[model samples]
Target chain A: MALLEIKNLHVGVEDEDIKILNGVDLTLDTGDLHAIMGPNGSGKSTLAAVLAGREEYEVLDGEILYDGEDLLELEPEERAEAGVFLAFQYPVELPGVSMTNFLKEAVNSVREARGQDELGSADFLQYMRERADMMGLNADLTKRSVNEGFSGGEKKRNEIFQLAMLEPKLAILDETDSGLDIDALKNVADGVNKLRSEDRGFLIITHYQRILDYIVPDHVHVMLDGKIVRTGDKDLALELEEHGYDWVREEAAAAA
Target chain B: MSTTALDTSVRPEDRFISAFEVNHGEALNGTNASISKQRTDAIERFAELGIPTNNLEAWKYTDISSVIDRPYTLPLAPERPSLDTDDIAPFLIDDLDAHRVVLINGRVDEVLSDIGDLPDGVVVSSLAQAGSTHPDVVEEHYGKYADFEDEALTALNTAFVQDGAFVYVPSGTVVEKPIFFLHLTATEQDLLLQPRHLFVAEDGAIARIVEAQHSLSDAQTFTNTVSESFVGEKANLEHYLIQDQGPSASQVHTRAAQQKDDSVYTTISATFTGEVVRNNVTIEADGSFCESNFYGLVVGKDDMHVDNHTFMGHVQPDCSSNELYKHVLNDESTGVFNGKVFVSRGSQRIDAYQQNDTLVLTKDAEIYTKPELEIYADDVVCSHGATTGQIDEESLFYLRSRGLSKRRARILMLQAFAQEVIDEIQLDSLEEHVAERVRTRFSSYFA
Candidate 1:
């Protein structure tokens, strides 16, 4: 089994039966970095939302296997404890919870989930200081309320900083490149690149190929109309970038 | 008991009438001769105003009619219940050494109090002693800020006022240690206590007044308290009221303050548990360039209802006032926050900001919040906002997606909400104490 496997997964809004993901099949083995590129309403975010066990989205059919267990059965927090990380598209701003405190609780929660002792204040502070420095997040930003008043780039970079701290086995970056300049994009990619390992995998979802210029993906999947139409190597992104998603859309339409 | 001005038809069975008769017969004559006139007028005014009802605009959400019906004996001149230092040591903060004035059932407990080294010219005496010893000073500042004519609670408190903590910091003196004003209500019988405290900080004086409540009895203890704080020119005073009363205790606390030129007055009220609690906090900025801040946090559960009423009056130009009150209600608890910022007509360049936010955890919990602003000055800057909603789902999901359980996430969110108010506390140790309190309160909500 792969690190995260989604086999013919179908999803939609739980309350309103608006289909989002229709029979989407994807798999990411250990050490794989896959990018899902698509236009708007391509079910790219739906896949991320469903994998993270968001309550609003229902898994209509099929299965999500994480570490040989049914991923849909776990709660959002449980999936996170089981090393599934989702960098939100619009990072939430918690006005009172300091970034530092949030990170401390998150780290301790994961440790407790794994049957490990929680970190002491001083020890956790030292550990966090090191990771924060690695991600180039300043001390002042870490001390502020969680993502409150953060600039667009700072919110993205903070997500990467958290990714470094949690060190999850599988990370889903949902629209991480939506709002970022080239410099910020490079900084975020650099942070993610540093955390790449044989035991880790990433599913980067985006609409543009600009971010792919920084963090090269091992596989690129083109999605349209609630399904992945094609999967190819990294060059496939450039092919679509040069020729545009027009060809991919026409090809899927003809096949359907 | 010839109080013809009082309307007996409202709550015909109210025991407050008898309670007032007992206080008028025993406690009134013993107060300062100068204060006796104020007492007589306030008692008459109490009879006229009577017990506040839910109909009044100021008290639209709180009803005191049921509370007054209970049979309660005002402990104005009752026999002292024997208590020792061990009985109150737990109520005192374990962190500090300070001047302590312990008021037990509306009377001073001199033996249990520990008055550590106070600065020279600083008077940390009981209000009863101060009324007799410094009668002129006590009379000059005592009820000067309180509005007994309009406030029934103030009138009721003033009519039966006997003794409370009194601290006077003279000009050019700095009281470095926090004065611990412990109002301990403990009795073997049903007792309604009326405690009156007068705090005066002279020109260039600085002090912090800490009012902590300790309820040792579950026998329907009701405490009615009135505190008047006066800050002189260029003086600084930080007042904090922390209520950790018994589960069934009912409390009515009214605090009024007048700030002088270039003075600073900041008050924080943190309420934990009470059957019914009504707090009226008023800050009138009388001089230019004075800064006033009011921050409060209320945590109630299990039929508890806490009502906080604050009036920030900007009477002078170039002064700034800020108020933030947050409430976390659970388990059918109810809370009300009515804050008003009134800017006088000619008070130009006055800045006032008020915010009230309530977080209701359970479906049965409810909150009534009203933030009001009446500005007459053309050049004044005033803003009032109120938000009553459940915890943020996005923030909760964010916290939970970071590995925190739903309960843990909710608790963190609530703590962060309270930390905003707790951070405004100027004192470091007090901030920790409040944070600890907020944490403890949320644990039960999660449980």
Candidate 2:
């Protein structure tokens, strides 16, 4: 069975006529790394948001199955507990919530859901420090309020740091390379690469192919107007990066 | 005792006046001529001012008619109820090392309190004892800062002032540990209590005082408390008021502080549980270079109502005063914050800042905030702002997406919102205790 399966999924904003996802169909098997490349407003981030169970977006039609279970039936936190993680495009600042505290709660909650013992404070802190170091996240950031007063690069890096802390079965990275410098981008990609495992699946959604250089995907899918228009190997990203998204739009239009 | 609904026949003010007349002799009996005169004047002032009405600007938001209209046992000197340490163990902050002073129904319970060894020339005693022990200090500072003539509740509290905690630190004396005043109301009958406290920190002296109010009964209790604090030249004083009484209790608390040259006065008032609570805090920077900071946090749940009225008078030049108050109201609870920063003429180079922030958790919850600044000085920096809103949806989703349950996410968001004010608490034990109290109190609603 696939790790994640979305068939003919249509999503719209709650209490509005605007539709964000017309029909998004994708499948991710265990150990599969899929990169979703799309132009602005192509609904790449919206798909990620829907997968994470953001309440503002409603799945108007179709289904999302995670491990053969109805994914739409789960709450956001429940989806997280079920080994799904979404690296937010814009990390919200939680003033007065220490980064370590947040990570501890997230880590222990997932562990509890998995029928595992809670991590001891000492061990957890040590592991957090190691992961933070790997992501080049300042030790001080772990002590301060979560993402409060953090730089753009720091916020993106912190997302990867959290993804490392809460190791999930299915990881979704939504534009994590948006505001990162080359070095920070490489650092984030390295962190992601380290977390890649045989039993885990990754869905990297990005507008650029910069991060793909560090962590190559098994397959690259071109998303246009909320649908996967084309599928190819890692070379597809380099071609799209060189030829720009205009050709893909033309191809999708011609096919339609 | 069971309290009947509000009775509008006899005016509430007249009932208080009659109660004072009946207890005047007993209440004022051991007082010196000067103290007795002050009591008499205060009661007369109370009669003139009467129970504050909605027409009064200060009392506009808080309508205490229901609280005052109900018949309560207005005992000037109520008999202390039997209570052991275990009775108050639940109210006590864990691992706190401090000189404890316990007041039950406005009277000090020496048995439940432990004011261990203190440095020489430091007076930490009941007001009745302090009256005879440090008569000069009491005479000098008492009723001087809290203007009973203007505030009717202050006048009412002064008229029937009973036993309360009094602390006086001599010149250059530093009280190593904090002095904790635990005011408990454990009464069999509906009670009305008036407790008065006076704290004086002389020149170069430093002291920290924490006053907490808790109740042990289910009966309706109304507490009218007045506290006057004096911070002398180069002295430092930190005062904290923690109001977490029973659900049936209501309070009208008045705290006034006078700061002298180069002195620092910081006060934090946090209210967690009460039916109706009104806190009036006033600070007078009487000398140059004085620093005054007053912060407050109110976590109102259910149908509770909390109003905080604060005033900072920059009477001297080169003084700085900062005010910050935050409220988190859930359910049908309502919160009000009216903060005023006044820079008097000739008070040049004054820096006054005031901010009030509120988080209305439920759609039914309400917050009314007004930050007023009256600056007459040309060379001063005065900034005042007030913001009231619901929790940020983005922040909430961010926490929930990280594996926190919706309830837990809401708890974290509210805690984060209230932490700015809680972080101002200097005492580690008290800060932890208050934070846990807020968390536990918030968790129920979220759950």
Alpha-carbon RMSD to native, per candidate: 2.6, 2.6
lDDT of 2 by residue, B1-447 (tens): 112222346888888777677667775555544456687888899999888878988888889877877878766554768899999998888878999999898888989999999999999999888888778898899889999888888888877776688999999999989999999999888888788899999999999999999999999989889899999999999999999896899999999999999999999999989999999999999999999999999998889999999999999999998899999998999999999889988999998888999888889999988878888889999998888888888887888888998888888888888899999999999999999998888778765
Q: Give the C-alpha miss distance for residue B293 in model 1, angstroms.
A: 1.0
Residue ranges of candidate 1 with Cα displaced over 4 Å: B1-26
User: Tens digit of lDDT per residue, candidate 1, span B1-447?
Assistant: 211222334463234555456556555566587566677687778778877788899989988667755656555564566888889878877676678888788778888888888888899999989988898788689889988989877887777677787889999899999998888787777767778889999999999988889788888877888999999999999999899887878888889999999999999999999888999999999999999999999987888989999999999999999899999888999999999889999999998888998988889999998888888999988888888889999889989999999999999999998889999887777788889878987887777
User: Using alpha carbons, what is the TM-score of model 2?
Assistant: 0.95
Q: Which docking band does candidate 1 fall into?
A: high
Evaluated on chain A only, model 2 obtains a TM-score of 0.97
lDDT of 2 by residue, A170-235 (tens): 999999999888888888888888889999999999999888999999999999888899999999
Candidate whose TM-score is highest:
1
- Stretches of model 2 off by over 4 angstroms after superposition: B1-9, B22-26
Q: After superposition, how far is residue B309 of candidate 2 from its true place, in Å?
A: 0.9
How big is the RMSD of model 1? 2.6
